[model samples]
Target chain A: MNDTDLNDLLHTAGRTDGTDSFDARADLARGRRALARIRRRRVAGGVLGLAVAGVIGTTAVREYAGDDTPTARQEQQSSSGVEAVRLVSQPLDAGSYRFGKVPDGWSVQGENAFRVTIAKDGDPDTHPDSFIGKLVIMLDSNAPAGDEVTHHNGREFWVNSDGGGDHTSISTLTRDGEPAGTILVQFPNDAGWAKLTMLEFLDSVEVLEGAQPSVG
Target chain B: MRATDRDAEFVEFVAEHRPVLMQAARLLTAGDHAQAEDLVQTTLTKLYVQWPKVRRSDNPVGYARRSLTHVFIDEGRRAFRSRERVVAEPPAPDARREEQVADDHELRASVLDALGGLPPRQRAAVVLRHWFDLDVDQTARILNCSTGTVKSQTAKALRHLRASLEPAVTLKEIP
Candidate 1:
């Protein structure tokens, strides 16, 4: 078919114009409840009940905790640069890590690493604890390239690549105020894929080893 | 945080561009409407979460596109465990079939059939370029393919369409 004919066909078959939103109001309301719940649970759980998975999957899942249970340290608080951010859990020791700048007013809902806190404001449980997102940082040798925002298991995510270049220190962070994990992985930039490092972010890990290194 | 009625402006931003988002979703999903909608939901939810970082970008739609691709790829991994595959078929023929569809339905049937035969990336290459009016380089970035692949796919799509459509045009007209 000619270009004109092809254009006509595509225009007809393209998606229709209309707002397909059916959950805007409900999701927002849920988000509000989430924020409120986060505040109540800031000190709800005791460190005594904290349990670290001694052995994780094929990939090692490390746990970091403070000398005590993962507790909220006197971290800075701010509402800037964070929005709708919620904490999942701080299983890792957060106070012991580097989380960029712990913005003002950001609370630690759960203790370190596994604590679930909210930043700016929102529900701490937007996603299930196990299904929730973690801030990931790895070697950026093979990151994916695109300008599109992405999602998975109801979580939104992204990866950036400039060209066929080699680099290091890539970070996959969620705005939620949880103790992050900084894992390692081999990442190779490829078409339609990122050659993931056989590792995950190892940030915000906490263990009661008395002395632990904190990741930002 | 929670998008309020006060956030009507943000809502407007999303509503105004949903059609294009939906179109992109359709291609990303290979035309599965439900999957496309889920992609949209995930993208929007993330957009809401990082609206500050995303809004600062020159193109929020671009942000959404990358995010949608991320989900699709991640789902490519363990998603088969929980969800049944749609078989990820190519586009069905676009011709309006009245159940008694004729074999010689001209270019419409031919084009769609061609689409079905194409590889996923090749089909994306064609739709993103022609339907979305994206340039070769842009299509490549979206598909994460080389520009050469985009050009090659378009060429391949055209040849197949021509072969299928020319034969249909030479057939008898409906009475």
Candidate 2:
């Protein structure tokens, strides 16, 4: 805590000879492999976000402090059909979850406090639009396989006419010890699994209280 | 040197500094050994790609630290789990594993717990100040903050850490 203690801890972080004097060859080589894993993250490629006319930009939003708060940095682009959508993304503030147990290629995304954003294997970009969009929304309320939250008379309804696939969505959503939502999705068959994933991610959006939806 | 030669040089650089980078990765990750190692490797890999330009920096070490943070953020694009942090122990005067490591383990656990209690910025400040021995300015560079911000963060971090440790220490009477 004191300078001395902090100094002592810093000293203990490593051996004396300085980091440049280290065997950087192996470290750099390993870095390449890790690069492959991180190359397509949300950083470099904004991905299919702008494509979905109904996109959630980080734009200015209602700010209020609470147990879980979101900071919006609104960004926008033109789409064929633009619908006002608000996005509230919080970092891993509380604590991130462990993925060593989850299936390979699956990741946890969105709210860091407690969340699970699943995308089909080998599909990185546009997942939120195709399947991930739909999944997150469906998780809030279970819909039969191939169902989308269709608004009928101001009520959100989960309906799937085509009998898409075995939709079993699994996620844990919590705020102040209360379950915000939960899901266990299974596709009827693997036919539209990939599409389902994208739609799920896109539709499965979490907007803050009173987020404006822009319509064009 | 040629591009290939430069790439080789960068690789050599990372091979050695892997452990130090691992230390940074270890803190960012919380305590995941494998992930820390992976992060170290990834940090070095980018340096290798831009070796020529990166090596030109007046501070190559700073370059590597920045690279590591970038890799961390990028990786979290998918998701990021914290790594386990290690608390260093002083060697016992006598050579006894049981007597030495037991307290060392307890002390290390307390230190990590204390670190977890701090906010992310404070944790980074404490880790940079104490673990890496970077001065306020250098730590600011690593954290991408002003030196004064680093100083305040260090102060706040120390306050929290001390508060966490005070209960364990007893006042000694000098007779």
Candidate 3:
């Protein structure tokens, strides 16, 4: 259409009855909760990511100094006199899933059968960036959870950018070339350790199918 | 601002601008009410997170609108269901309207239908150029493209609209 006709048409097409009432209260409440939830995850993820990176880095340094890393020790024990010497793993529980090797101070916030929100200790509800905001770990029966795949410790994991303002990182736990679950991590823009820490955490996570033993 | 005050201010902002934001989102989503609502919700949530900075900005309204458009464009690519196409058939002419009014609405619907068939960027160009009457430079600023790209996209989109609408509508040649 000519410019004027096209303008008129576009306006008319956008016209609504204006009767659709939005519950600002409900929406605001929902928005607040969602914001809080994101805050928690980012805080928890940020802190946990840093912590894990620190631990892993320290362990690697120690191993390089000729001391055995935890995994290395476990491997040695299995080789020497045992069938399997499981490495000491701390369980971070969310609903029916248990993630082993969570560092201290990180607490599980929200959980369901499929997903769990874990945050660092303190007032994460009020502090959006508390301890690492909140890190979300979820199990998706559907394979290939994220867009990009990268290998860590010889295991393949899918990773992608969520395109959020914080530029959250999404990495999926893969089993036999398929996604078993996902880890969503958000860190401050200046946190150079974000990607490396997230990869390390995903590499070390052990996802159990059912509830944490205590919960069961 | 204190977090509580920031939150209160954001709530006020959403209350004040939700209507207009919903309108733009409705158009961006091609009249899918549910999808439009979801888009608005997501945009508002982002707005809330950045409310402190957004409030200090020169034009909060424009910021909100731009953010809404960006969210729409950004998500439309990643999600399959977010891109809802218009139905094949236009709604029947309203019996309640006078013939002229009904004709007008039908023409508008046809234009909208054609608009729906366009790719997201083309549709955005048409909306910004024809609907909002933005200058090439202004449209470029919103679309994050060069002024020449805005003119080119608007021209191409207008041509598509002309072809689709045919005899009932006419587009002047892009000079």
Candidate 4:
């Protein structure tokens, strides 16, 4: 078609009638909620910055006091250890996929035969298609690539932090009979997902027969 | 601007421009009403989060439209990686009786189906250039590409549209 014809066609196709279902009120409410979420995140970030500054100050004071003894080192090591977040012992279903455990306060946002996305409760960005700040689980035939490999509970896990360091992907081979590909879980770094917890959660995913491998 | 003022302005902007944004989104999503609505919601929420920037922009509607395109492209990439697969055929068109003439609805369906078949960026190029009547430089700015790239993309999209819609609608050949 010529330019004018193409323009006319697009204009005709893009037209929306008065009967079009668009709720401006709901859009405003959602917008308000998103603004609230942004404010909360800012406050949380400020608090975290202050806490980090306090820890640094305290550590500097301790170092100035010649507290570098073996006993002090042991105490520091013990206190700085990451406390693994445990998943709740509950079964969750997302379409054809099933989860034996999930992090507390997290709920499934979207799912298909190929992938399932889980996000924190009360997350304002409820667009299932958006995976930012969420945990996504999928199966793919691509070989698992990671920075480190660790074995837990008879299953090997590959842990790779994304280039931005904002997210980590943990992948493990699916058990025989479920799917012949790797089951991968990518979790946001700020979501309180320790490597151990990620491994445990990935372990709990049961890829059903209907599950399809996600194409790259 | 003050918080209350910003909120009020944002609400007013949404009330005035949301329908226009929805129409653009409908074209971007190739006429999927539910998806178009979701895209609009996400775009509005993002705009709300950055209301100060929206207010500062010379054209808030243009800024929002740009944001909508970015969201659509982002979601399209994610969808490509996560769920896109080869479909053997497009969905069947509506059945028509021999006596019924193919109307605007049928033509609209044909156009949307063809638009949906184009890659997301190419489809976006077509929508921005044809539906929005944006010049090449403006389309390139929204797409964050060079003007030459916009021309080539629009050309390819037009060629595809010509081939796809010729049977359903009368059209002069595109040079």
Candidate 5:
């Protein structure tokens, strides 16, 4: 066929001028719900995965220690300085460690050799000026020894709170009394909610087997 | 801005563009109305997810069109069309103008059949080039291929269509 023939055929083919039957109100509502479901599923999957990993890690430790009782681990938590309660967990894949617990909506925003920062996933394009503060978790593996030691559910963690800015807390965690991982938690200024979340996250800190010292 | 306002704006956009997009999808799917509707829905859902980015773009319509093409391409790549399907026969030609109408219906069916017979990429290239009147460079950008690829694919597709259609009826009779 020549150009004219092709054009005529295509014009007839593409002529969908008034054939649309989309229900915008219904579709938009459905789309919004779908997006919400997707986000929820992601969060749920992350939570479930981390929780399972925690239980498996704890079970292995208990089995290695020859502890038979279910409350054996719970008893250990009471002896530690920090209180233990359940929360959602996360793995900063690069750090070779995971957050034992984190507040909802605090997804990993950035990561590097020195740190992995978690913050609310703000709508930057739409809400450019909206203030959504950060909670940074830094990794410092260069130091040979830790200055302070804190215990949580029988796990020893080295505590170093930076007095300089917004109370940045660097806790070097250990598993089986060895340097398992290091983390630095930074709270935003005037962020009382973040401060509370940071404290809770620190209390739930448990070192996993994968802490390698490399900048991401 | 509040999220509701953004949602409303997006809804407005969908209402305005859905007809044309559905038409394009219908053409792309070889006049399969049901598949075309599904394609448009899928495209619109994607657009909804990226509405903020789309709203900020200089050419939202072009972006949506490109997205629709990509969606169609991806689904075609997945080989989902291998599932069994049955296309119903078209209605009989009108009795009053039986001969002319039957000829016309036969021509339309043959045109659609030829278009559908092409491989997905070749079909997409042909539709974007001829149906949308996009230049080789524009079609290349949308198809995420080189201009050379677009030219070759369009040429091949046209050759195939000509082979199927020329002797019996020119493609222009498709109405």
Candidate 6:
């Protein structure tokens, strides 16, 4: 068959019954809800920015005021020496991959043999294949390329930031007796993940035999 | 744009263009109406979030089409991967001897089944190039790939379609 014939077939298959069942009003409602959600996120981000700025300003004022009292010094130490976030020892399963520990408030959303997506507890978008604002883990044959390398638990992990430094991807070689490829995890930079905690989580993953390497 | 004004324009746009968008999405999802609707809803929500940009574009409908296509290509990957199926079994020898003819519904099912079997990018190439009547460069722009890549993908898709549909469809040869 020629192009016209093929096009005809596609049109025929795509044709809907003439009932006009599409609900434009419903779409409008959904759109408004999404817009509200976007606005809320922007507001929350702005608030967080202000809080960080306030902390910096307070620190500078204290330094200029020569407030060297023990209590003030302890408060400054506490503020400057914020504890690094760590993963909890709770087991989580995503398809053939298993995580010995994950950061609090994250759970597996969906997974196939190729990749597993984990998202925060309150993420509105539930689509597993949509990776935005989620953590995606996959196994691939590509060599790990990143700006920094860190050795942890006898494995080397290559770390890189993408999406204009908003996202971070860390790749490391899978352990022996499992898939022979790089296992990579990608997460947003502001998702409250410290570099050491991310490394610990990556070290905890176990790639089973059913795992398959993703293709480009 | 003010909130109420933007919303009015968005509602109007959806009312006018949703049917065409749904048709395009049905083709993209290989006749899966449920998934097609989900794709349309997601696309419309995205367009609504960026309503100012949509209104500024010279062709709002075209912009919506491009967004629908991108959403299909991006988030529909896993769905398409799971939906892939083997080609239908060939007709029996006796039926072939008698020159089997299929009705419109049967032909459409066969075509959609074949289309569903293609890899995602190849299927997108066919839908954009043939179903949407887009030029190679236009398809490449929407697909975010080079024109040479578009030509190669479309060629591969056409080859697959011909091979799969030849036994199912017996159209007259064009001179």
lDDT of 5 by residue, A54-138 (tens): 6655644663465657675453242223222223555335344366666555466654443455655452422211112466554
Model 1 alpha-carbon drift over 4 Å, by segment: A1-5, A17-216, B1-9, B27-30, B69-113, B161-175
List the candidates ranked by TM-score, beginning with the highest.
Answer: 6, 4, 3, 5, 1, 2
Which segments of model 4 are wrong by more than 4 Å?
Answer: A1-4, A54-216, B81-102, B173-175
Residue runs of model 2 more than 4 Å from their true location after superposition: A1-4, A13-216, B1-3, B70-102, B169-175
Candidate 4 CAPRI level: incorrect
| DockQ score, prediction 5 | 0.17
Better of 2 and 6 by DockQ: 6
Error of model 1, residue A46, in angstroms? 14
The second chain of candidate 1 has a TM-score of 0.60
TM-score of 5: 0.51
Q: How does model 1 fare in lDDT?
A: 0.42
For model 4, residues A49-95, the per-residue Cα lDDT tens digits are 69777664554455336476675444333233622244777998896
Best by lDDT: 6
Quote each prediction's TM-score: 0.43, 0.43, 0.54, 0.54, 0.51, 0.56
User: Candidate 6 at A83: error in angstroms?
Assistant: 20
| A60 Cα displacement, candidate 5 (Å) | 24
Per-residue lDDT over A1-216 for candidate 6, one digit per residue giving the tens place of the 0 to 100 score: 223376778888777777558778899899899879867876997799687877655654564465677755554443326422346788878887999988667778879887888988889978776677788888965666564578998899988653334579898989889889889898766666656668888899999889987532
lDDT of 5 at B67: 79
Best by DockQ: 6
lDDT of 3 by residue, A55-113 (tens): 65654454335556576544333222522212235755557655655534556666655
| Candidate 2 root-mean-square deviation in Å | 18.5
Worst 10 contiguous positions by lDDT, candidate 4 chain A: A75-84
Best by TM-score: 6
lDDT of 1 by residue, A24-85 (tens): 55444443454355435544532322432221111121112221222212111112221212
lDDT of each: 0.42, 0.45, 0.60, 0.73, 0.59, 0.75
- Which portions of model 3 show Cα errors greater than 4 Å? A1-3, A53-216, B80-104, B171-175
